[model samples]
Target: MARKMLIDGEVAAVADGGHYDYDLFVIGAGSGGVRGSRTAASFGAKVAICELPFHPISSEWLGGHGGTCVIRGCVPKKILVYGASFRGEFEDSKNFGWEINGDINFNWKTLLENKTKEIVRLNGVYQRILTSAGVTMIEGAGSLVDAHTVEVSQPDGSKQRYTAKHILIATGSRAQRVNIPGKDLAITSDEALSLEELPKRAVILGGGYIAVEFASIWRGMGAEVDLFYRRDLPLRFVINFRESLLLLIL
Candidate 1:
């Protein structure tokens, strides 16, 4: 069998005992999975970690390198948020006695374009982190073939089994869209970061931090935001309001 000298992959130097093949097999190449693999490898434990192809919009199917953070979650979300926050920063600059220009326009397409590029860059960086750590990085989805063994499905429909003393799952959380009739029209926080056009009338429903933050962001970007929560707060009906200032919940 021909193997590259610099190959940090599953095909290892076969030993007579094959006991040192892999001490750990990380099922998902997400944050916790990759971290665990690298840490174990660093401490003289053999490791192999697998992940799906790079995806701009991550689902269960097409999740990419760097896990949810780079492909669809934190990296893209933060980039868009940073891009959107400038609108407010511009407003605050005017109040700070700075002679800012008139009617600063927020280009959703441009911000989305830049965010996509930044997210891809971060994905590559994460790949480097895993590879440079001497942890064998496999590109595919892993399944439990047995108790101590896993079957990895490659991009070309090829299957290979890996055995390890320990198996780990680190596939991070995924964003879920609402299950309604018109749910297809609405995008989750993941797809929202890559919107082609700014929503003219944005309606957000939920009491979570993502919902609140997105509402604030869209409002800042000049969208007519109608935010709804399960419970509504009354401003004027204050029974000693200064005690715990829970203001403007929705």
Candidate 2:
């Protein structure tokens, strides 16, 4: 007589109904998680998303709502790149019949401060977007308790558990330093983005997009950069623009 349904490959009775706390529980508040939660919530499903508190530098338990791309990765990197590119622009302006006065100085501190303010503003924007979509936002690190349950570890050392019909994990990724001598002394991209002072000279490792981007960013800002990679050439896999990219790096 009671309704029957399949959950986790087992037949379960749905006669009681309204058993779970939410229709959906998202484990991360990154771009992907936020989008997914919003879309689901728009469809009238009760949704909840949990993420760590806001911080520029990410850890296992300190990522912001906008996630890596907005908080520390792409958005911040592009801002620095634009700030650095001004030096070249100023020089090129001379060719365009523009007379420049005294010495043009780049202040790393000012750029860093403004970049952080923009990131913080974007983080809040993402939170508001989620709220507007009728999604519940929880501040904490989320872990899976079971197939349909999530346990969030709050910042104040409190744990809250919730049940949902479905769970999604979009925790994103973090930067990892290579294992070598003085590895501890080396900083990852996370710390690099929020440095107190800009390095007069920088030594970068690897040949990936991030490595090359940083090298260019620092070089544009008037830093002495030495890039080292164990490859025949940087961006070897980028067959299309490899030649042009190589020239840019050099």
Candidate 3:
């Protein structure tokens, strides 16, 4: 059944809301889902968003609010980068004729604890935002049961079904660990951010942004880093050619 939606100088077929519990049902409470639900709710649409329960460590059943960017991706990575850069600063100060006498060391536990606290705080903030926007936030993993119905599996093994006029999927991404021998011994960037001890030797095996960033981070913090990529040039496609050339020259 084709339905009509009013758009910019156009009418398009939209979801038919003959019998829906909500006008909008979002699958994930990541940045996109939260924003979309909030916007729809502000426009007087009945919106409900579902997500996994909050935890410092993420898994299939324990994804927190704020999604990848807020929890495991950008926020935590940048915090680690900032903490790691201090070693570079201390080293560079010697060139500037500053006499520093103390033995500097990095505390992985301290940084991890602080980062966890900050992410927890941000999660609460996102929850409050959803509440203020009048969006019903459900805690669970949502899947499409039908075109207009979502089935959520909660952490406690309970399930709930919601029918909506339109459903949104914004469950965000996860780190893909490469398959190899002894793969369990290796950690992805997500785990790297929360390591209990800084590694003395590290080998990163990718040319992507995350790989290179982790390489730089560990190297800056006094780790022996060997980055391996299939291509002769690292970050070849991602970095601007001229900028990469300049960096290599330098």
Best by lDDT: 2
lDDT of 3 by residue, 76-136 (tens): 8888889888887888999999998977767778988999889999999999999999999
Superposed on all Cα atoms, the candidates' RMSDs to the truth, in angstroms, are 6.4, 4.2, 4.3
**How many pairs of residues in model 2 come into backbone collision?**
0
- In model 2, the clashing pairs are none
TM-score of each: 0.80, 0.91, 0.87
Lowest-lDDT window of 10 residues in candidate 2?
1-10
- Candidate 1: residue pairs that collide: none
For candidate 3, the TM-score is: 0.87
Candidate 2 vs 3: which has more TM-score = 2
88-183: candidate 2 lDDT, tens digit per residue: 999999999999999887789999999999999999999999999999999899999998889999767899998877788999889998989999
Clashing pairs in 3: none
RMSD of 2: 4.2
Model 3 superposed RMSD (Cα): 4.3
